[model samples]
Target chain A: MGKTIAEKILQSHLLDDGAVVEPGNIVRAWVDVALLNDVNGPIAFRHFANMGGGPVARPDKVVLVCDHFAPAPNAPGARLIGDMRRFAQEKGIEHFFDVGKGGIEHTLAPEQGLIVAGDLVAGGDSHTGTAGAFGAFGTGMSWAGMAAIMMLDETWFKVPESMRFELRGKKAPFVTGKDVILRVLGEIGVDGALYRSMEFGGPGVAELNIDERMAICNMMVEAGAKTGMVEPDAETEAYAKAHAKRAYTLVRADADAQYASRHDIDLAAMRPMVAKPYSPENVVAVDAAKGVHVDQVYMGNCANGTLTDLRQIASVLAGRKVARGTRAIIVPATQQVYVQAMKEGLIEQFIAAGAAVTTPTCGACFGGHNGALDDGEVAVATVNRNFKGRAGHAGAQVYLANSYVAAAAAVAGEIVDPAVL
Target chain B: MIFEGNIHVVGDHCDTDVMIPGRYLSLVEPCEIAKHIFEEVDPGFVKRVQPGDILVAGKNFGSGSGREHAPFGLKGLGLSCIVAASFSRTFYRMAIDLGLPILTCEAAARAAKVGQRARIDTASGEIRIDRQVFRTQPMPPFIQEIIEQGGLTAWVKAEVARRRASA
Candidate 1:
């Protein structure tokens, strides 16, 4: 049988001359890139030191992004972040993106052209599935996995059973990749695709832009998926050539590839969705959440904080007033996203609309900074994962939604359909 | 590693972000991070869990984020072992590297209860609780070797040295 895109990528990285592996098979393959962020880098560096402080195997392929709490949230955060920076310099990893240069690792990797199609990328953070939008077999690893990757450029992967999410039809206004993926998550529940790849394709993938594709794949983690991918096309080539410094190869699944499961999503019928506390998969249409009062609104994280998302939110908030009692926090995903938003006047629109703008960080999303919620409060956030207390107080609730809805909720002080506005 | 302890049960999809909330992520110290493990689920969970305690959890234990703090926190809290119906990929791998034994037995999740004295055999894949016994897939011997060598860091150090020496 022909292989899926994930299988093809894994097979290409096989160390042995004849490594015939299939779904559910455990195979050891070389990792093309080792991705690290401030949150995981310090722990990984400490582990590496504990392992006799060995030199990194391939410095060029190692990327360390300081986006979690850049500018340092506290003394310990600063100290740990400092150690991560020193390790990048000491290891001679030129790809270390610090402070201004770094953004959310998932978003930054694609924009900086660090990841490309037909590669095996291992990110130390779970959202590494974001790279899969580029048609790479991206997967999340722990600190020990990072140690193995850095020291030997190798790790074991259980060739996941593949789930094909075939998308068809055009999306309605305010409904983007986030909606499509959220619908999929709702259908599958959190662990629906456990250890499986959600290979996205069909007419719908071509209809969406690179950023939209990114938004969909970014939430694969939220679905408890190991990876999410879209087959490479002209836009994929164009994006790589425009963003990536190096050349990349395009990979395609065989026409007759056998899939373990297939889910068909009709984009036209997908309504703006929200994942109410405290699970990303516990989704309902925005209208179902009407009058669900929100104390705060957050719209920036590796998942939904893209230029496209900003443009959408900016258009929604331009000339609109944020509700008197609600606080809206807008964070662009990257420095580039920040600058572009400024140039486009989205920054002015947000500020004039009563939103607080912050530099790019995983803040507020992970309950780390800017708009951490207080107990008994509720928030509508554009970030992924609404797991209990994820954004701040353990009792504070968060509703995960698309950027458009985030903007509307910011202004409405409740979960309202942006389309209705 | 053969371990015996009182089982403490946690529910399905016990997210890692909740186990050690993101707020405590900046604190890399094991003991400090352990203070927040299960802080969301139960504020006093860490204080109450004794050394050599075994955690029996429902499906998809340690789901969410790749932060090692979740597994590492449990390790530092003196959790000798965890047996869940299944585990999140990163959490399962982190536990192995932390030298914490984990067994995936469907029966264990339903059979285990708080303060239920249980004995687990990593080699035999047998988990004994009260008068009942559940079988799980035994981890590979090489993995046990890695744990015996003191987890991933020590094993990696030795491997790196061996490679350099061979070269």
Candidate 2:
């Protein structure tokens, strides 16, 4: 049997057990990158304090960002940042990004060249799988797991069986990778492919640029897949060409590799989709989901805040005003994407439409920061989550959707079809 | 080491956010996270759970965001073991490394019911459910060490102390 890209990366970092490790196999492997944030950083700092020294390993490999509660919203949050800063300074970790410079941990990693193609990365955040967008095998761990990687440079991995997603025809206009993933969640239901690595292939997948593929793979967690990836191809080559420092080789899964299951999606058949309240897997087409009045519309996160996402939102919102009584909040994913959106005039269109443009942060997605809804409020957000109280008070509701739908919902003051708009 | 506990069965798709949502994420104290464990699904869980209870759930247990607090919360609540049909890969790795015994007994989903007495042997991967015997995937040596040291934080402290004494 031929190897998948995941298999090849695992082999490159395999430990001495010499076992062809499969999922649940106990195997130790090296970490290419390790990331932490304010939430887990303070605990790690306390552990480091008890250990009585700098990091047990080098600092260059570690990334510490204060995106969790940056700007120190309160006294306790401020003190958490203080602990993180002290830890970074003592460890000589130069990659530490303060409040303004740092965004979401996953968004900051790739833009900073920390997550390169073919690299195996680990973070303290579950969305570490977000790095898999670059064709790297990325996952998150606990503070203890991170500390071990900090000390021994190795952690165990159970090689997950692969699930293949083959995209066929082209996507319809106004539809995007976000729609494709929402459709996948609708088909598979959450936990459909548990503990498996869902791999993407096929001609339709190739049409998407790396950012688009990243958008799909980034939300795989919503479907309960541990990680999802597309086999890096020429589009991958072009993406790495600009961001990567050293030359890198693109990788693909072999033809005969084993897969737990396979799915074929025809992008042309898909319509803009939305995941209604309670769960992302609770999906429906835009037309099928009419009249779900939304009090707020948020269009940003590691999932849908790329330059592509902003441009698409702008395409529909341009020259139009946001509907009264609806608040549209636009947050770019990274500094680079923010600058690009500003340069392209997308930011101006968004603001002129009465949308509030905020700095890049993991806000609204986790309900932790800005735009959190009041009790009984309903939000149509392009973020990955929609569980009860996910955006605010327990009585609040969050509806997940693509940027187009979110933009349309903002303009219509309810969940509406972009095509209709 | 072995763990004995009351087992609670959560159905499929017990995600991490449901295990511990973002509102309580600000609380760094594990005890605080413990107060909200399963607040979404089991509103009375935090207040009702006793020490040394095992949480048994269906497939894809602990899916969603990568928050160590999820595991920390459970451990802090005196959750001794988590036996699921399988776990989301990230949570499985984190649980083991953090010294939480996250064992998987594929048959346990069908065999073990809530309020059942479950006994788990970490080294041998044997689980005794009432009178029935079930086998789980045995944790590796390194993970066993973390558990033995009572978790990663304690393990690092022990190592640090050992180094001081030797020096």
CA RMSD of all predictions = 1.3, 2.7
Report the C-alpha lDDT of model 1 over B1-167, residue by residue, as the tens digit: 78998888999999988898888888888888888888877988988899999999999899988788888899999999999998887788788888888888989788788889999999999889988988888987767877777688778778788988999
Using DockQ, give the best candidate's number.
Answer: 1
> Residue B13 of model 2: what lDDT?
66
Q: Each prediction's Cα lDDT score?
A: 0.86, 0.79
What is each candidate's DockQ, to 2 decimals?
0.77, 0.53
TM-score per prediction, in order, is: 0.98, 0.93
lDDT tens digits, residues B33-121, model 2? 78888786679988767899988888878777777788889989998999898787677766875678888778977788978899999
Give Cα distance to truth, residue B5, candidate 1, Å: 1.0
lDDT of 1 by residue, A1-421 (tens): 8998898889989987487778877788998889998888888888877777657989988999998878688887888779878998899989988888767888888888889888799988899998877878888887877977888878888888888888889888889888888888899988888888889988878878888888888888776788879878888889988887676889887888889888888888889999989898899999999889999998988867889999999889878999999999988888888999899999998999989998888877888877788999999988889888788888899998999999999888888999777
Checking candidate 2 for backbone clashes, the offending pairs are A23-A159, A126-B66
| TM-score between model 2 and native | 0.93
- Note the clash tally of each candidate: 0, 2
Native contacts present in each candidate (fraction): 0.77, 0.61
